[model samples]
Target: MRFKNKVVVVTGASQNTGVAIAKRFLEEGSKVLINSNVKDDLQEVYKELSVHYKDSVMQYVADISDEAQVSAMFKALDEAYGRIDILVNNACHQGIGPTFEEIPTSFFWNVLQVNLQGTFMMSQQAVSRMLKQENKGVIVNMGSNVSKRAIHNRAAYVASKSGIDGLTKAMAIDLGPKGIRVNTVAPGYIFTNRWEVLDEAIKERRRTNIPLGVEAYGKDIADAVLFLASDEAKVINGSRLVVDGGCSAQHMPIDVDF
Candidate 1:
């Protein structure tokens, strides 16, 4: 139990990667606060996780994009846990449009507000709280392969993720002196429920493009996040841990031949 007695906050834990990270932290013996903007989904996950970890879990529903709500959420966490240890900024927004021109400006800005600004807000509060603690803290921001390489139809998501990489570096430098480690876990083609309905041919094509010939499960991302948050990463800071199965390491696989 690496995280025994630690208090963890996983934003956007209603489903997918966030939930997976929360589960791992709980399993490692941390008291966890699961968060999501969706009340119904949050309540359901709260109950589901509470079955095994009733005393170690709590649910907080707050839209991370809203500053007031973010403050309130952290205030509640501080009251409950006294001090924060690890933070997984897994909350994100994907704004996809048929074409660049088709995407509304508001939608684009909303993605930035939640993905970029939300991380800033959460980290700001977490650092202040951790400053009072003896051991300090760890912050793992969720990034994407798109942060390094651009993909079509997701200009907003691409921009937001790229910003996360930059934000991770700045936060690391600023907080490293105070004993906090900051890093990012960037995943590629994580197979979530949204892709469950995709055609088999499309899925196979995606897998073929990856060097590992497989998409990541949400747990794959969680494993990377936990590593960066653990004591094992004491000297590693300001690094983007690409957990995308070598997807970022390759050039175009189709055009090049061995």
Candidate 2:
């Protein structure tokens, strides 16, 4: 029960990594608030585990990119739980797959608006509430290994994640004195449900890119977040923890071998 009695808010909790994080927190004794920009009947998901951890989980619907919605979310948190001890910025627009030159500025900004801007806003709001408390809190920003290396056709995502790295450092510096810790979890090649639609050839290529011979799972990233949010990481802050399966360890071949 590393997070016993803690209140954790995870954005984009409808599925994938977000759901994994929420489930992990509940297992570790944290009261979780799951958020999604779009709400759906989570009955099946809830049904599977709600019996095991009843009342430890709750759901909230909000657009993290919208200031008003974010503000309202925190307000509701204050009203419902009185304080939030953990916040996971996980919601992001998986921008259209297109080259930078072919992508529109609107599409670019929209991605930033949700990814980078939303991260900043949520951290700001969470910090404000955390400051009012005697005990400090934690904020985990989801970054990407691609943030450190530019990937083709993912300009907006890479840019936003890179921005998250900067945001994490700055927030850590500013909030450290106030007892709040901010950090980032950067993962590479995490295979989620979305990958199920990919052809076998593409899957093989993905495996090849990872030196570890396998892709990361949602639980892998969720475990990292749980550690960072726990007292075990009391000294860890402003750090970018890369959970890549060694995918970011090598450079591409300059030329194909004959």
Candidate 3:
């Protein structure tokens, strides 16, 4: 119960990594605020979590990219929880296309507006609210291995994640003296909703990219965030912890023969 009595806000908690992060916090004795824009998914997850956590878990549905909605959500948090100790910016958007040039302009902008700008908007509100409260706060932004390397076709995603990492560093330096900590956890090849319906052949091929023979799970990413938000990482700030199962360590694929 490292986070016992702490109030946490996890953006994009409708499903996948968001749900995992929220669940982990609840298990660690934290009061969690789950946020997501998807109505049906949000309601479903809220009901499921409400069963286990009851009054400890709260749901706030708002698109992080929308300033008015973000403000309203924070206001609601203030009214309900009174204090926020940790914030996990786990929401993201990635537009699919074969090449950058072929991608639509609207798609490219949408990716940045949500993935990059949304991160900034949420952090701003969290920091402001934290300053007024005791214990300050901690923020963990979700980054990706695609940002480290120029992964193919996901130019917008790679760019936004890379930008978020940069934002993490900037926030850390500015907020450290203010008693707030900021960091990023970059995960590679985490198996989520997108891969749920993928063919076995595709899954096997995806595994080939990861040197560890298996991809990361949503829990792996959540565990990392929990550590960063805990007191154990008090001195740790402005760090980008890569939880990719050594995927980022590979420079070239090596042939294995029995």
Candidate 4:
């Protein structure tokens, strides 16, 4: 119950990594507001989670890319909870593959709008609200190891994630004065539903690089997010915690000597 009494807002919690993180937080005793743009099934996901947390989670359907919706979501949070404690910017459109020239210019803009701009907007709003309160808060940006190591056919995602590193540092510096800690949790090739869409050969190659001999799970990333949100990481700001099973530490194309 490290996050007991904490009010948390987790974007993109309909499924995948975001859902895992929100569930973990709920297990740790935090009141969570989970959001997803798809309104139809969002409540279903919330209700499913309710079986585990039982009324500790609320569902908010808002497109994080839209400033109005974003504002309304946070405002809703304030109205319901009266204050903010921990914010996890986990909403993102995984714009995989497609080079700049191959995809439409709008595609690039849309990716930036969701991944980079949305993250910036959420952090700013959360910080503004947190500043009004006497207690400090934590903002954990969901980043990818691809920010440091780029893979083939993921130009937009790579660029957005790399930008997250800069955004994380800048936000940390600007908000540190207000006692708002900002950091990123960069996961490398976690086995999500999205992973199934990747090429088999690529997955095999990634597995070979992982020192742990297996792919990292979404729960692993969730645990890391929980730690960063906890008092244990009270001093960990502007840092990128890479939870990749040491994937980033290995050099690709190493000669396998028999």
Candidate 5:
């Protein structure tokens, strides 16, 4: 248990990659506070995790975009765990569908509010708490490969994730002297419950684009996050760890026959 006795906070911990990150941390013996905007979703995940983790897992419901709510969540964490050793900023607004020209202005702003502003606020609170502790802390932002390579119909998401890359670098430099490390985990084409609905042909066609011949699972991304948060990555900071099954390395999709 690399994280034994460590206190962790994972935003967007109710589903998909977020849930996976929280579970991995808990398994490694961290006292984790799981946050989600949906009360029911948070409770459901809490119920499942609490069954095994019991005292080590706690759940908090809040919209990360709201500054007050974000502060309240941290306050609750302070009361529960007293200190935070790692924070995984995994909550995000995907901003899927609709071309840039066709997308509504309100929808675009909402995406930024949750994806960019929310991360900013969450990290700010985490840093404040970390500053008071003797051990310092680590902040792992959930980024995307699309941040480096744009994807169709996800303008807001791409923009927000790209901003996270820049933010991670800036935070690393600013916090390094204070003993805080910051990094980004950029995952490409992660397989989640959403992919379960896609037809077999559609899934196969998607996998063809990846050189590894398989999409990343939530566990895959979780492993990267855990590594960055561990002592093993002591000097690693401001780096973007792409967990994309080599998707970003190729110029074009591999021709199966070639």
Candidate 6:
């Protein structure tokens, strides 16, 4: 139990990667607070985890992009946990469809509001709380390999993730001396519930593109996040840990050999 008794807050914990991270932390003996904008989904996850973890797990509903909601959530966390030890900024607005030109300006800003500004607001609150505590803290931002390599239609997502990379580094430098570490975990293709409805051909094409011939599961990404948040990564800061099955390292897909 590396995180035994640690106080962890994981945003976007209603499903998929967020739930996985919260579960892993709970298993490691952390007092966890899970947050999601969706009340029903968040409650469902809370009910499931509360069965196993009981008093160790709690849930909060808030849109991280909204400053008032973010502030209120942290205030509630303060009442519950006293102080935070680790923060996982896993909430995101995945800008999946529409090309850059085809996408509406409102939609683009909406993506930025949630993905970029949300991260900033969350981190700002986390750092404020951490600075007042006696122990150092860790912040793990959920990034994407697409931050480094652009995909076909996710222009807003790519831009926001790329911004996160820069933000992580900036925060690390500013907070390192104050006993805080900032880092990002960028996953390429992780198998989630959304993938369940995808066409087999599309899935096969994605698998073929990855050199590992497989997509990572939510647990895989959770492990990486845990490592970065643990004491094992005490010296590690301002870094991006790509958990993409070597997808970002390649010049092209394996089938596209010249």
Give the per-residue lDDT digits (tens) of candidate 3, residues 41-160: 999999999998998998888999899999999999999988899999998896567598788888888899898899999999999989988789999999988888877898989889
* Candidate 4: tens digits of C-alpha lDDT, residues 1-258: 788889999998888888889889988899999998988768888889888787688889999899999999988998889888999999988997687679878888889899999999988889888998889799999999999889877788888999999999999998888799999999987898877889999888778778776887878989999888888988998999999888788776343522
Give the worst 10-residue stretch by lDDT in candidate 1.
Answer: 249-258
Q: Per-residue CA lDDT of candidate 2, range 125-190, in tens?
A: 988889998887999999999898888898998899999999999999999888999999999888
For all predicted structures, in order, the TM-scores are 0.97, 0.94, 0.96, 0.94, 0.98, 0.98
Best by TM-score: 6
The Cα RMSD of model 5 versus the native structure comes to 1.2
Model 3 residue 99 distance off true place after TM-score fit, in angstroms = 1.7
Kindly report which residue stretches of model 1 are placed more than 4 angstroms away from their true locations once superposed: 255-258
Better model by lDDT: candidate 3 vs candidate 6: 6
How well does candidate 4 score on lDDT at residue 164?
95
lDDT minimum window of 10 residues, candidate 3: 249-258
Show pairs that collide, candidate 1.
Answer: none
Candidate 2 CA-lDDT value: 0.87
**Candidate 6 — which residues are off by over 4 angstroms?**
none
Clashes in each model (backbone N, CA, C under 3 Å)?
0, 0, 0, 1, 0, 0
Candidates 5 and 6 compared by lDDT, better number: 6
lDDT, candidate 1, equals 0.91
- Candidate 4 vs candidate 5: which has greater lDDT? 5
Residue 191 lDDT, candidate 4, scale 0-100: 91
Best by lDDT: 6
Give the higher-TM-score candidate: 3 or 5.
5
